[model samples]
Target: MSASPHPLHELDPAPAPSVLALVPAPAPVPAVPVVPANRAPRANTPLMRKEHRDNIALFRYQVIRGAADPSLSTRQRGPLVRALALVDHPWPYGGTRRFSRESLDRWIKAWHRDGFDGLKPDERATAPGTDPSILLLAESLKREKPNRTTAQVKRIITETLGQAPSETTLLRHFRAKNISTGARPVATGRFETVASNEIWVGDALHGPRIGGRKTYLFAFLDDHSRMVTTARWAWAEDAIRLSAVLRPALETHGIPEVLYLDNGAAMSDKSLARTCAKLGIKLVHSAPYRPQGRGKIERFFNTVTSQFLGEITVTDTPMLPGTAPEAGSQIGSLEELNTLFTAWVNMVYHHQQHSSTGQTPLTRWEASWEHRTPVRKPLETIRQAFLWSDTRKVSKTGTVSLHSNSYEVDPLLAGTSIELVYDPFDLDGEITVNNNQGIPAGTAKPVDIGRHVHTKVINAVKDNDTATNINTGINYLDLVATRHRQSLSGAPISFADLHDHTTPKNQTQPAVSEEEQP
Candidate 1:
C-alpha cells in the first residue's frame, strides 16, 4: 500500500502549475524629477514676505559665528565677542550698525545652544507696545542730552504728548537707536596732538604675576608720534614707582607740556601734582570712568600684550635677537622682564610703522625733534620737585616728628607749624624747613631716626625687588641705565649715595682735598 501511494503522488505532480504567474508586479512610481543643487525645492520655496526676517537671521548668524564656534575656549570667545561688538556691520535694511557687547554675547550664547534657527527673532503675537512717534521722541531727547535718564525722558514725553510709554519701553528704544545714557556717540572724532611731547598720556596696566606677586605696567605714550615715551613693569602701583618711571622719561625724552593721566590713586597723588607744578607741566586727569583721550596708550598696551608679553616667559638665558624664549621658560625676575621689554620696544615696536601716523614711532619722534626741542628741567630742580613734604608743629624742644622719626629744627621754629620737605626714600637724611610762607628757614637734622623710608616706599621695595640676583647680558635698558649713571657722574647730588654733606647756606664750607673729592 505504501508503494502504490508513492506512485500516485509522483504521478499527480502534473507539471507543477506555474507559481510565478500568480505573483503580481509592483506598480510603477511616477519618476520624481530631481531638482538641481542650486534650485530650491518647489514645496519649500522662500517667500518675499519672509525675506526680511531671513536676512535678519543671516546677519545675526554672521555676527555670532566667530564667537559661537564650538571649539573655542572661553578666553577665545570673549575676545571674539568684544572684537565683533566693536565692528560696524552693513545692515540688511539700511545703513551700518554696531551691536552692543551685551547684545553680541547674548546672541552668541543663543547660537551655541541652538543652531542657526536660534538666531531668528521670535515671532511676536502683537506689535510692540511703544508707538513709532514715541520712540522717535525718546531718541531725539537722548540725542539732545546724552546724560538724560530714562525716567526723565519718560516724564518729558508724558508732558509733551499727554501720554507716554513706560520707562522700560523708552529705554529699550533708546538702546536700539544707540543713544542710551551709557552709549558713546558714533561719530566722535579721534584726538591727537600736533607735535611730539605736546601731550603724554599715562596709564597703568595690570600685568602677569611674577614670583607669586602681581605686576603693574606704568606707561606713557606720546600723543603725536604714538611713541612709548616711558614704560616700566613694577610690582606695585604707587606714586614712588610712578616717579621712578616718569623721572627717567622726563630726563631722557624731555618734559611734556601736558601729562594726561587717569584718576587712579597713584596718578592723582599730591606728589605728582607738585612735580607737575614745579616742572611747569600741566597735569590733566581724565574724567572718572571716561577714557576718551587715552586711546593711543591703550592701543600701545594692546600691542605690548600681543607682541611682547605674548612671546616672552621666565627665562634664564638671554633671548636671541629677533627670537622668542624657548617654550616653557620661566621669567626669573622683574629685571629680566624689564630688559626684555626694553629690547622689544627699541627693536620691534619703535621700528614698525604705525598705522595711524604712517611712520615708525621712532622716526616720527626724531622728525618732531628736528623742528623743536623738548622742554627740559635741571636735575636739581627735578629732584627738589619730587621731594616729599609734610607739615608738623615743632615741639617746645625744637623738634618735629615725621613718619615716627624725630628731627631737630631751628629754635625759632618751635611751637610753629612748619612744612618739612625731604626725600621719602631717605627719611634719615636732612629735611628742609619751610616757614608758613614757603620760605626756607633752616634744615632739620635727624635727631632720632627709625624708618629710613616712607611706609609706601618700604612696601614698593619689598614687592618690586623680590628677586634681584637675575643676570641679563647686554640689553638696551641696561645700556640706558649705564648711560644715565655716566651722565650723572659729575653731579654732587646722588640718590644712591645718601650722605649728610649738606652745609648751611649762610656758613662757609672748607674746600675738600683732591683725594676726598668723591
Candidate 2:
C-alpha cells in the first residue's frame, strides 16, 4: 500500500515562483513639480528707490482713499479736474510724464477689477530699466510742498502734457517708493513716577451687577510702586462714593503729590477737584481719549478682572457659595465681596512682586517710603478738609436747607448764616454747622419741618456733641511746669510753644509740685 502513492501528488514539490517577487518592479514614480503662481516680492526688484517707494505707497493710499471718498463728486469732472490740476503734486521717480488722463483711466479700471495688486506690471523676467524722469518725479513728489493727491497729480500731468496722466500708473511706478502710507509707529511714553506715592492714578471699574443693580469699583494705584492704595465698591460712580474711597487711602498711605485721573464721572467731578485743592493734591486729568497716563490703574483693573473677579464674580462658574445663587440678592453681601477683595489685596496682591517694580508692591513702596516723608493726616482731619462747604442762613426754626432736606440746628444759630461742613451723602443726614468764629456749633440732623411744626423744643444736636479733644499737643501739663516756674518768678510764662516747630523738645518738670513742697 505504501508503494501505491501517486507521483502527481508529490509531497515536496517546489513551490510555484512567487508572483509578486517575479513581477518586474514598476518604474520609479516621478514627483509632481510645484509651480509658484507669483514670485516673492524682492527688496531691490521694485522700479522705485527706497524713498520713492514710500511716496508711491502714499500716492496709492491717497488714490484708494479718494476713490472710496464720498466727498469728491464725479458730476463736476471739469471743475474737479481743473481744481485738482492746480495742486502741486509730488512725484518721486521723475516728472509726472507718465501720469496722463488715459493712463489714470486704464490704471483705475485695472484697480477696480483687481484691487491694489492689479496696478503692478505683469511678470517680467528681467527688471525693467529704471526711468530717470520717473525717478526724478518721485523725488520731487516726496519733497513737493503741501503733499498732492492722485487727482491733483492727474490734473498736473494733464496740464503739462496736454493730456492727463494715469494716477494708477504713476502710483504703480512708485509703488514701493515709500511706506509713508503705513501707519506711524506708536510712540511709547513713560508714565511712571520716579518715587513711590509721587503719583497716583485713579479710575472706576464697572463691575458685575448686584441685586439687579450695577456696581462700580473706584480704585487708586501708585504709579511707581504699582500698588493699589485703596478700592471701594459702590452702587453709583459719584463724587461722594469716590471721596469715601480716596480718604481712606490718604489716611493709610499719606497723600500723593499728583493724582492722575480720567475725565470720567468719579474723577471729573467738581467736588473731587475741590478736595484735591484743599489737600494740596495736584489733580491731573489725562488728555481726552488718551489712556497712556492711566496705564497703572488700567493694569491693576486687568489684574482684578482676571484674578479676583474671575474667581468670585457671580458671572464666573466658580463663584462663592452665596454669590448670586439667585438674581434678587446679588453675590453674597457687598460686605462679603469687599471682605474677600480686601483679603486678596492685603494678603496676596501687596506681597506679590510687581513686574514693573521687580519687588513686591508694598516692599517697593516701603523702600521709597524709607526716604520719603508722607504727610500722614488723621482720618477726621482728612474728612474735615475734604468736606464740601457753602454758606446758608439758619431759619427761624433753627434749621438749614441742604439738598432739599431741612436740618434742625442750634437755636443760637437761628436766623444766622453758617458754613456747613458735611459729607454730601451723610447717612445720618447730619451737618456740622460752623459759626463765623469757625466753632462747631452743633450737628444739624434732617428734620421734618412739618413734624416739628408746633414743637417748642429741638433736640437736633447729639448729646456726644461735646467735642472732646485729648489735646495731644501743648497740654495743660506742658504749661503747668511753666506756670510753676513763673510763680517762683512772679511773672507770665509761655511754655507750650507751637509755632514753626518741625520738632519739639521734651520738656522736664520738677519731681515735686510747688503746692506739695513743705
Candidate 3:
C-alpha cells in the first residue's frame, strides 16, 4: 500500500537535479568585425556619393539665404530658386567629380555670418597684433581725419599710436566700427545766451568783388565777446557747408551753448538741427526779415567791410591818376586770402582786446573755457549731426534721386519711401537713410551727380573763365570808344577823342556792345 515507501527514498529524488549548479549552452551570437577608433562611423561612409552631400548643402544654403532676405518677395524669388537648382545639379554619385553641397553651404553660411570675413578663403587671416586698445586709437584717428584714406588713416594711427596697422587692417577696423565721414548738423532747440561763447552768432557777408567777381564771407562771433572766431570765403552760404567751417571753432573754442543764425537757405539744413541735438547745443533762429537779433555779427561784418575791406584792397591800385583817393586791393588769391585772414585773425583780430571782454578774443575764449565743461559726444552721436533730410522715393534699382543726383540703397528698400539724411559737407556723398519710423536703415555713399555746396575755386572762376583762364575778353578801349561814338553830340571830334575816351568799366559804364555783358 505504501508503494515501496513512495520510491522517493530509493532514488534519492535524483539528487534534486543538482539545484546549486548550472549547465552552460553555446551562444548563437553572429560574428562582429572589430573597427579601429580612427575609422569613421558606418553611417558616414563614402559609399554614398560626395556630390549628394554637396547638392543637399547647396539646397539648404539657398533656402536659408532666401529666408533671411526680407527684400526678396515670393514672386521675386525666381533667381534664388534658379541659382539653387544650378548649384545642386550635379549630386554626388562618386564619379570623377566629387563635390558636396555641404561644403558649398558651409561657405555660404560663413559668409552670411561674417560679411567679407565669411568669404575669406583662409589666406587673408586677421591681424595678429590686434587688441581693444588699437580700436580706441583707430577711433581717435578717425575723429581727426574722418575723410582720410585708409593709408592716411593708418599713417596717422602710426604717428599718434606709435603702432601703425596695414591699410587693410585699418579698413577692417573701420568697417568693424562703422567709421564713416559725414557732415555735422546745425544748432537746434531754444537759443539762450548767458555768457560769451554761450551763444555764437553766425551770418554771411557779401564782400567787395575783386576782378569783377563777388565773394562770400562766413563768420562766427561769440555773442558776448563780439569776437570773430572764424571766417572764410565761399560762393554760397549753405547751412551744411557753413557747419564745416564752424567745426573748428566748436572743437577748439568749445561748443557754444547756443547759436543764432539767419534763415538763409544754407541755415535750414536738417543736419544742422540734428547736429545741435547731438552736441546738446541750442539753435536760435532770428525772426524772419529781422536782422537785429543777429546784428552783432552783421555789425561786425560791417565793421570789417568798412574798416578793412572798404579801406584797403588786397590788390593795391590807384583809384584815379593824381586824385590820391584811397586805393583798393584784391586778396590776391583764395590761398593768399586765407593766409592773410589767418594772420589778421591771430595777430590783429584775436589778439586785439575786445570792447566787451576787455581782453583779447583768444584770452576771453580761454577764460570762458576755463570754467566751461566740454561737451563729450560719441562718434555716432556726432555723426548724427551730419545727417540731412530729404524725402525721396526708391527707384526701380532702389536708388533715391536728390538734387539731380542719385543715391543707392539696399535692395530690400526697393519701392519703399525713404528719408535721406545726408551730410552736404562730405564730398564723398556719404549719407544715413531712415524709414518713417526713424530707424536708421544704414549708411551709404551715393553717386555724386550734383555740384557741391562749397568749392574752393569760387563761383567767379566758373562764371568768368570761358576756359581755364580767368578772363572774359572785354577791352577798355572797345567799351570807351563805343560809348564816345554814341555821345558825339554833333561835335567835330577826331579819332584822338575816341582814344581819350578809353576808360575801364570800373570808371564808367561801357558802351552798349552788340553782345550783352554777363
**Best candidate, lDDT:** 1
Q: Write the residue-wise lDDT of candidate 2 on 1-518 in tens digits.
A: 23332221222233344422332443443322222425423445545334334444445434333332223333322232333334554343333322433344454455667665566555444554545565455445433422334433443344334554365655555554652322222223366778977888888999886545566788887888777777766666776556656755675578888998889876887778878887888989989987787666777776666445644424323447775332111233454445456555665567667766689887877788686587766555566666677689888978887655678888898888898776543424456788977798878777743342111111211111121222122311222223333323111111111011222222122010111100
Instruction: Quote the lDDT for 322 in model 1.
Output: 94
What tens digits encode model 1's per-residue C-alpha lDDT throughout 1-518?
33222210121222334322222343443322333445533222236335545556777876666556666555445545656778897665445689987787677777777777777787544467767877887787667545556764664565456788887777767755667456322212299888998999999999887767777888898899888887788778888878867765675677889999999999999989988998999999999988887888888776666445544455435568998434212457775566556555665577678778899988888898886788877766777888878889999999889999988999998898999888887887768999888899989998888999888777655553444454445422343334333222222222232222342122111110001010
Worst 10 residues of 3 by lDDT: 509-518
Using TM-score, give the best candidate's number.
1
C-alpha lDDT (0 to 100) for residue 257 of candidate 1: 94
Please report how far candidate 1 places residue 499 from its true position, in Å: 9.5
Candidate 3 TM-score over all chains jointly: 0.45
By TM-score rank, best first, the candidates go: 1, 3, 2
Q: How do all models score by TM-score?
A: 0.54, 0.43, 0.45
Window of ten residues with lowest summed lDDT in model 1 = 509-518
lDDT of 1 at 499: 25
Tens digits of per-residue lDDT for model 3, 327-421:
32234444433434433444445555655447876676566656766564544444456455677778788777776676778778888888787
Candidate 2, overall lDDT?
A: 0.53
RMSD of 1: 27.1
| Model 2 stretches with alpha carbons more than 4 Å out | 1-189, 313-331, 391-400, 405-419, 425-518
Candidate 1 vs candidate 3, TM-score winner? 1
- Shift in Å, residue 411, candidate 3: 4.9
